[model samples]
Target: MRLTGLLGIEHPIIQGPFGGGLSSVALASAVSNAGGLGSFGAHVLHPTAITGLVRDLRAATTRPFAVNLWVPHAGEGDPIDPTPHIARLAPLYRRLGVEPPALPVAPDFTEQVDALLAAAPPVISFVMGVPPRWVLDSAHDKGITVIGTATTVDEAIALERAGVDAVVASGSDAGGHRGAFLRPVEQSLVGTFSLVPQVVDAVGSPVVAAGGIADRRGVRAALALGADGVQIGTGFLATRESNAGDVHKAMLHSDAAKVTVLTRLFSGRTARGIHNGLVRELAAHEDEVPPYPVQSGLMQPLRRAAAERGLADYVSLWAGQAAPLTASRSAKDYFKELVGT
Candidate 1:
């Protein structure tokens, strides 16, 4: 089925889910109410929090909306020493007037899945990797649409085999974490323009083009490439209703938005954002950073402090290459502009 028909939305536009507290109920419900799928990235929330989040979205919009999760990769639970990683970031911690926090524990993915299933939202989306067969079957049993993200053609094929209702062809130009699971992220960095048509041809499931897409022009381009829909992040993120920090939003509307570089400094996973001092200084030592959740936890205190002080340097200013095309507006207005409603 086409994305719109399958998802029960009027337009084939999905508001890309934003993890790390960037997603907001206001932003999501606004887009959903405007005839598009709105998504909330719940990877960081506890299981109970996930339930509450769904309830909040439900209270706000009668339309369909999606709750997104990051499928845990292998070895994600393994213990690793954070000493070296902490030492490397000590300077930044001091500069931010904060101390390195204790090793943080990531929310259990299994528990999160259980909570989501119980909540039974209209749609569920996964990134990083595919969910187990039982989970997919259960979601379908409950009449929920399931979407999986892919950065490569092989991954798209994998998602189709996994029986996902749709696949988001997330290219390297996407902001936030790369969802490359079949191979290393470096090997999966295909551009959106190159990826969408290939994925559309590779999978029988509907294809949603993501990455570097912020306006109707990009939406037309994606459809031209045979995509069934478009998933937009940076564009919706710049809207006033989004939960992004003021400094981060300012950068999206500035000249700096024109240049984004992928780095693992913030979360120990490759994510694209406006090139800033923190990214530049740590460019050489990216390999030394600890794996995700740990690196992400380690940086949280500093990132929080930086945001409080309005310091964009230390905050994770995640944005895509199309960020320069973003404008400060309400998400509802932006949705209208996107589909010409």
Candidate 2:
């Protein structure tokens, strides 16, 4: 059976989970009501808040929705030391006339995961890396479907070995952070078209092709390449119901999306987003930016300030190559377009 048959959805479309306040209950429900799976990134929220959000999402619609989490590799070093990275970007903050915030205490991942699994959303998707064996088992025990993302075939194979129900072939062109599990972000760049087929063949499970896909053409292409479904992010960012700021939406209308590059300067892990001043400057001279959540911690102050000031250049305005094809409409409209295909 096709993967969508297992999902029990009318269409093979999924609104990929968005971090940084992009996903909303209204948007997720809208898509689910429209016959596609809608998803949200739950890792960014506090455990209590995420539980409430999941409750709210369930309230919005009985249709299926997905909650995403980032399961990090517990590295040897502590995730502190924002001082050195902060000093590097201090000048950028000075130019913007705002003070960079001192780092907060590191987040409690174990507590968050415990809450997430306890909430038991219908689907639990993971990015950056695969979950530990116990994490996957716990989700399965609750009858929650599991999805894993990878930038290369090896990672996809590993995820399949870990027993994910589905795999997302996250190509380099997909916006947000590169889902590199086996290699450094810089070394793991692979496009969606090439990566999807490889992963499909590498594993017995179905694949959901993500990255750079925006419109019907992308949908047709992914299906043609053996992907059972496609997960789209950047295309929805310009939608009216999206949580992105007005100024950020305007940036998407311009040529900014076409010039995007994968840069780790923003949050350490490489993400493809609208290329602007900070990206251009930081890409030149900088250390590897620590690791996933650590890099995200160091840049939080500047990103917050930039978002507040409506300064596009200083923020990591996450976008994908399909960004150029994004339409400024409600997500419902975009959902209609995808289903009509």
Candidate 3:
């Protein structure tokens, strides 16, 4: 499929938008220059930083790209209360020479939204849920194509009704946060093979498939299964341009890659990643993970220490299920290999 005319791109490949210190200028530009849509996860960045990032990406590659963000959805879950989870990880933090932070982090999403307008990337993809109607309308008015993630046909139809340009069917095999807008993630784990066609059948818009797709064969399979485009994350994590830590890249090639488990320890939201020591422990005690931003906030100190000391367990190293077969290459080379398959 044409992937909605991505500025003369021949392949329907979109670099999966990764956030929480993964999206990088080099990675995005490389994909764009390679005749595929490069996407930057801008939800973690503020307006000025995002604008500068967009400008740098433009300088690096003349081709078009996208900026992605998470829609701020309302929830009844307590925003603050790391007491339950922090109590569990306090011993680990004390050992790391850092004090865990308090809960209920008010992430600066509004500033990020402002930044997206200034950067005005050709496309804006949202995860976590569909944005407010005004946000969608404003984005379209600015000529920004909107893509929203869904895990089921119900979610896909919701996105279509919300005026999204495309619906990304993020199956259960996908890494990172599971965008379950319709039901709890546990009950909505639809694999791409089963979810894509159903979503396409339910919606009039384009359907993008993600989760466990790491190569050209996966891309071809998605197309055969009724996907207009395929979004690959774990495959690109091993690429040279990716900002993932060295430990993360190494893990992609290790046997532990096959043992991925879904845990809510880091973000208090269900996400799958490599099963590390911390993952093993967390899996046994995941019920204590507070709530969204709270758990994410309390884990910052541990994650920062881990990053500084080359420790993998302290961070939420999100990766798809196809991690074991990962191959390292430049972003452009990675895309070539993908489209070639």
Candidate 4:
């Protein structure tokens, strides 16, 4: 089936689900109303909140939309003691006028999934890893189209074998977190041009190309490379409907986009963002940083403070390498521009 038939949308464009509350009902509904699949990144939300978010999205638009969640792992390794990292950031927290963190409780993935299943969004996408067999079965039973993110051909094959409806072949150039599950993220740093067709050739499922795609040219390139559709993140994040902070949005349009860097400073998982003071300061101390959510939790106060102060330094201005290509417009207008509508 063509992408339009697969997702029942007029265009093959999808707004990448931005996690950490950066996604909004307004943005999702805007994209959906404009004839594309909009999505909410529900990774950080609790079960009840997930239900409420779904209800909110449904109320906003009857158009087909998607919800995304991170497939929970016991993390990549054993949880490290977070005290040292918290202490290191204490000075920054004090400057921001917020207390430093104590230990943080990781969100319950099972409860989140159960909540999502109950809400029953039209499509559910997984990143970082694939969901369990029973969860996939449950989603299928509920008539949800399960899409999994892959950074390599092996990961794409794995998802197809797991019976997912589609696989997003996310190249390393993509913004936000690397969804490499089988190999180390550094080893899976394949460019979009190289990755998409390889994934398409290896899997029977439809392939959605993500990473460094911001304009019509990029979209056409992905489709030419055999991608059934395109998933865009930084492009949508720059839109007026997005919840990205003023500082983050400004950075995307500024010269800072020319020097995007991948570092674990923001969330302790490798993420691509514009280079700023915070990232530079913490770059040398990568080993000291705790795992994903722990480091993310520890830095929450700083991020919020940075946002309030309009300081881009501490905020995670997650963007792709092609961030400068993003346009500041409404999600609908941006969608139209991307598809040349």
TM-score of each: 0.99, 0.95, 0.94, 0.97
Clashes of 3: 0
**Candidate 3: stretches off by over 4 Å:** 2-8, 76-79, 102-105
TM-score of 4: 0.97
lDDT of 1 by residue, 1-341 (tens): 38899999999999999999999999999999999999999999999999999999999999999999999999996898899888999888888889899877789998999999999999999999988999999999999899999999999999999999999999888888899999999999999999998998899989999999999899999999999999999999999999999999999989888889889889988889999989988989988898888899999998899888999888899999899999999998999999876
| lDDT tens digits by residue: candidate 3, 170-236 | 9899888888877887889988889988987889888889998998789889999888998888898
Most accurate candidate by TM-score: 1
Model 1 CA RMSD to the hidden true structure, in angstroms? 0.8
**Full-model lDDT for every candidate:** 0.93, 0.82, 0.82, 0.89
lDDT of model 3 at position 92: 87
> Which candidate gets the maximum lDDT versus the true structure?
1
Better of 1 and 2 by TM-score: 1
Per-residue alpha-carbon lDDT of candidate 4 for residues 1-341, written as tens digits (9 for 90 to 100) = 37668788888888999999899999999999999999999998989899999999999999999999998655443567777787788778887899886656766899999999999999999998878999999999999888899999999999999989889999888889888888888898999999999999999888999999999999999999999999999999999999999999999989988988888888888888899989887778876787788888888888988998999888898999989999788888888888897
Q: Can you write out model 2's per-residue Cα lDDT over 1-341, one digit (the tens) per residue?
A: 37777676778988988886778888888888888888988767878887898899999989888998877665723646667767787787788776777555544667777888998888889987878889889989999889999889999999999999999999888888777879877778888989989898899998999987899889989999999999999887788877887767888778777788777787766778898988778776546566666667667777777888888888778889888899899888998897674
By lDDT, the better pick of 2 and 4 is 4
Report the Cα RMSD per candidate.
Answer: 0.8, 1.7, 1.9, 1.3
Task: Give model 4 RMSD, 1 decimal.
Answer: 1.3
Q: Report lDDT (Cα) of residue 245, candidate 1.
A: 92
